[model samples]
Target chain A: MIQTVYIIGIGLIGGSLAKDIKKSRPDITIHGIDTSAQHLNEALELGIIDEKTTVEAIDKADLIILSTPVDAAVKLLPMLLDRVSDFGLVVDVGSTKSEICKVANAHAKRRNFLAMHPIAGTEFSGPKAAVANLFQQKTNIVCEIEKTAFKLQEKALNLFASLGMRMRYMHPESHDKHIAYMSHLSHISAFMLGKTVIEKEKNERDIFDMAGSGFESTVRLAKSSPAMWTPIFKQNKDNVIETLQEYISNLTHFKTLLESDDFEGVYKEMDETNYIKQILNGIQ
Target chain B: MIQTVYIIGIGLIGGSLAKDIKKSRPDITIHGIDTSAQHLNEALELGIIDEKTTVEAIDKADLIILSTPVDAAVKLLPMLLDRVSDFGLVVDVGSTKSEICKVANAHAKRRNFLAMHPIAGTEFSGPKAAVANLFQQKTNIVCEIEKTAFKLQEKALNLFASLGMRMRYMHPESHDKHIAYMSHLSHISAFMLGKTVIEKEKNERDIFDMAGSGFESTVRLAKSSPAMWTPIFKQNKDNVIETLQEYISNLTHFKTLLESDDFEGVYKEMDETNYIKQILNGIQ
Candidate 1:
């Protein structure tokens, strides 16, 4: 029964959602709102949304998705809670969950807010990087559904299903912790790996020459936007740290086996971690 | 001036090298030697090499390249050295260096051997993965050059140069230590990250849903062959352990900041790591 949808921060995730939803639901009015007028203009020209709206312009919409960065999402949630229509549902697609979820939890419209994080993105960002099928076969995490009204959660569920994403409900704390290990730590490792290699190789040509798919895979995060990631690490700091420690410990153990010429032990350890293959079997 | 060259292993690295060398020097006869007849047969069919040869068949070649897994390279080098012509040159493209260099150094034909590692590979392996442009503009690391005879090193210099690779020289020990940090540890971190997520997510559909580009970049190495990587971890265990420890320590420090609600410290730490952006400025 949702008719009008407003998307804030029309960057990669938001813009792509706009594009896909527009492509599928021809009758639903899609309104794009962003601090960047240029992004809004681009989204409009691309027909990603029906039109661009100011924060105040789309106050009547049934659903408002805050697809901004983590810090921005936290900062803007209280204000939107103040102005959102009685039946309107507000969702966020930020990477970090705990802070934003907590910010909206105490609101009078707390039952009207649904905390959402759709896990789909590319190395590239912005409206230009947005694509029609970005969310297809991806996972969407909806944190603390108990805080939202059952009807609002139901509305959010329909939105995710329409976009072809499977949904998981988690506590905000748990979501941040799991993601820190599974996502944020990876970024730090990649950035550090890129930094380490670039330091040793000195000449970019050496990295260009020596870096194969291994280095490329490990360092791909180096190309990620500093603006997006810095806030994520800040928001999910504890979890990110814990996951990083575990990862580093595993690696240190691996090194000790190699140093001692313990081929049998080293091979067995990797073979065990190779159980990761079984784990990846589940990945789409 | 190298007219006839032999390539052992006939997998991605060896086959790709043969194809590129043939493209660059049509008159140079390329001989392929692999323990797997299927691979040797495929190499010929793909025109990756000009002809298939056996151990004795390639004995008289001017140059022999051992492009096999680290385990296989260790086993094959001693045998190849026994048959190498007094004036012939031999090189290896194994992932690990120090052990391979040590095994070859005490051989009577030690002076004829050049311990080399071309820092390039895709996730895919074998002849099918072989592509002609693999080594172009890549790095070819020649280790323990002082152990190589002057004449043989000259030929190695020419061969790597012919492949359009920039050359870096290091003692084999140094190469292993540095590479453990740069290359080996990255794979372990990626594999474990993939495992950890897979373990918790349980549902592949959930992982696929939640996995953004960050997860993909961090887990891409999970697609790599366990056969190829097992020996590498075994060989470079010492340095990998050290690097892993340092990495873990950093993570723990960051985690402590998070637990203490030190948002300022967390933000500042991530900001410092962002300096990696400058280091990677020229890497394309």
Candidate 2:
């Protein structure tokens, strides 16, 4: 039943979805909307979307994806809910979900929207970085799926399923908190690790010359877009702060063990953390 | 001139080097030695080494590679240097250098020893995890090169270069200090990051279900062998402590910016750290 697709943010997540959906559903027309006219233009030239349109023409869309930064999505969701056609369904792919879900909850047309986050990305961002098959075998976390009308849920779920995503449903608050540990804290850890090393690279020129692939993998997330991450951290401030405190405490405890020559404790700590190997095996 | 390679620790690095050398230098035989008899057996079964070796038979080798844990290597280097033939070259692949180099310096056969740390590895360890070509395009940091005889240096350098590695030379003290920032801190950061998230996962069941590839990459080093890292930290305690202090301070500062709601500061910090993208580009 979904025919015309309107993606509100033509960035990495949005553009990638457009590319995948276009490949699978050639009969469907894809309309890309971005505040940056240049992005809309690039999306068109990249063949990611078939048309360009704005909020004024949103009612024509059978499926509308809200893929802006979390803050932008929060502000835009209510306005979008007010304008979408009765048959149209809206879904968001924001990293944080609590704030966006709260905004949607207050809307009269609450049943029209679904809050979902697909755990997929690279350090790179924007339309040019978009690629097909980004979502294959990736977990799609859907929050408050019961709030959306059952038929409209099918349309959205079908979209994700058709693209090879496995959906896991949860509450919006749970999504924000769990993601703080698994995703947000990892980003902060990487960014700060890069900052610490870059600060050292200033006084010593050859530090990077000795840096190996381990350094590269651990700091890879430091290259993520500030525009995308800053808002997620801001929105989930308390949870993120909680995770950071735990991380810093662990690092400080490690420093103490090293300072006091309690290498046995240090070894035990890392050996224990190596349990992540089993967890990561399950992930991959 | 190198015919027999006596590898003292048949773990990831030593076993990997043996596999590659055996492939490219079919005329040469690789003799495996390890505290773990199971590892020696695994190396033989995996075709990573040609013969079993002991220190008593070390003089038969033209090249001796000491690839033990840093603590073990510090204790073993002097013993190997004492027993090595005048024409035999001994080089170590210890993660920390100052201690090992100091140990080698006090010995009469110091010129027969070289201190090197090839920055290539995986989270896995031991002979069963070894793979050929792990050193291809990787950095091999050689410290105290001036202490090595010209011919012995060529013997070691040719071995690394033939395996397709790029070499960087530095003093032992400088190598430890720089690598503490470049390599050691990243491991601690990752191990501690893994520890914190695992603690949270105790209460939150679905935390990793939301973890993306970013989280996995950032914490991959947490899976590295604690036996290997514990000695590296012990041998370079002062440098590791300094880098950990810097890393903790940066994380605390970022948390403060988030707590104080300085979205602008948070954004600026990450934006500045994004410079790592360009630096990493140069590396790959």
Candidate 3:
């Protein structure tokens, strides 16, 4: 019975979801909203959405997807919950979940909102970067699922499954904490690595040619859009700080091992971390 | 003029070179040597070499590839130089350049050795990980090329070109310093990032499901062989320490930005680092 969908933020995540949703339920009419009129136009040209509309027209939709940055999502969730139809569901696909879930919990129509953090993305962004199968077999972490109306939750879960997502239920604060280690720290590590190399390469431009596939893979996340990531860090500041401290501590210990001529300790450190291969084997 | 080739170490780099060299120069006899007898046997069984021979008999080889770990290479280069035929060319493909080059520079047969480091490899290692054309379009950094005899250098250069390598001439010290930022720091960052996330996952084993392609890419190098990487970090300690200090400083600054709610600063940091896309586009 989910016949109409209104998607706010016609960027990579929203536009990609629109593509998959359209394929799964072709009869559903889709509307897209964004601060950039150009993105809405791009989504329409890409056939990711059927029409372009503002937030005011969302009430007529069966689903409202708020895929903006976490800060924007935080401000819009309460307003979206207020304007959503009795049968309509509101979902926010922000990176950090706790703040938005807290805001929604305080709203009168809290049961209409579902806080989600779908851990699927490439370094690329924008409507044009949207692809149909981006979410295929990707994990969709659903936070505060109990706060949503049971029927709306069922519809959301079914829609996600139809789009080929593996759904995992999580509470908001815990979701933020775990993600700070898994996802946020990775982005920061890549950004800082890129910054370090870029700073060095400025003086020795020839060093650029020396970077192989290893450097490229490690720094690929550094190419992600800052507009989307800055707010994620701002929202999950404490957890991010904690992860950074741990990462820096590990690096400092590595330096100490190197300084002390302890190749065995260095080897042991890397040997233990090799377990990540197993953990990530379950993923990509 | 090259008929017999001796590839010491007989692991990933040595075995891979053996594959490409065999394809290019079908008449040459490839002899494999390794500290691990199993690796030498694996190389022989895989057809990466025509024979598994002892290093004492390297006098018959026209080209001797010292592809062992840095510590082993440092110890063996002088002895190999002592035993090599007058026309034989000894090339060490260790990751660090300065230490091996320094050791080779003092040898009586310095004119018979070429210091080389091919900046190409996957995270996988061992003779079994060897693949044909692995060095295709890869950068091979040659240090102290002038120290090798002109005829031997010509043979090695032409042989390398035949295997589809692009050779860049660099001083050993400069190569180590730049590689510290470009390549060594990447491995350390990936290993430490993996360590940080793995430590967190021990408490909540379910967090492994939350990892995405981004985490996978950033942590990919953590799976690299510690036996190989330990000697690399040991040989390039000072440069690696300097690069780590700079990287840690950058991560700390990012944390400070998050602490003070400076979303704008965070955006600028990532936005600036996003230039890595263009830099990396030249590579991979």
Candidate closest to the true structure, highest lDDT:
2
Model 3 chain B poorest ten-residue lDDT run: B275-284
- Candidate 2 C-alpha lDDT tens digits along A1-284: 89999999999999999998988788899998999999899999999889888999998888999999988999888888888999999999999989988898898999999999999988888899898999999999999999999999998798788888999999989888899999999999999999999998877665677879899999999999999999999999999999999999999999999999998999999999999998998887
What is the TM-score of each predicted model, taking all chains together?
0.82, 0.99, 0.98
Q: Write the per-residue lDDT of candidate 1 for residues A1-284, one digit (tens) a residue.
A: 78899999988999898888777777889998988888889889988888878888657888898988888999999999889988898988998999997899778889889987888887667888789888887778888888888887887688678888878888888788767766787777776665555545555344343445576677777667667877887777667766766666666665566667777775565555555545455564
Query: In model 2, which regions exceed 4 Å deviation?
Result: none
lDDT of 3: 0.91
> Can you rank all candidates by lDDT, best first?
2, 3, 1
DockQ of each: 0.36, 0.91, 0.87
Model 3 spans > 4 angstroms off: none
Candidate 2 TM-score for chain A: 0.98
Q: After superposition, how far is residue B76 of candidate 3 from its true place, in Å?
A: 0.9
Per-residue alpha-carbon lDDT of candidate 1 for residues B191-272, written as tens digits (9 for 90 to 100)? 6666555555555344443556677767777657777887777677667766666655665665676677777775566555
Ranking according to TM-score, highest score first: 2, 3, 1
Give the DockQ (C-alpha) for candidate 3.
Answer: 0.87
The candidate maximizing DockQ is 2
Q: Tell me which residue pairs clash in candidate 3.
A: none
Give the true-structure RMSD of model 2.
1.0
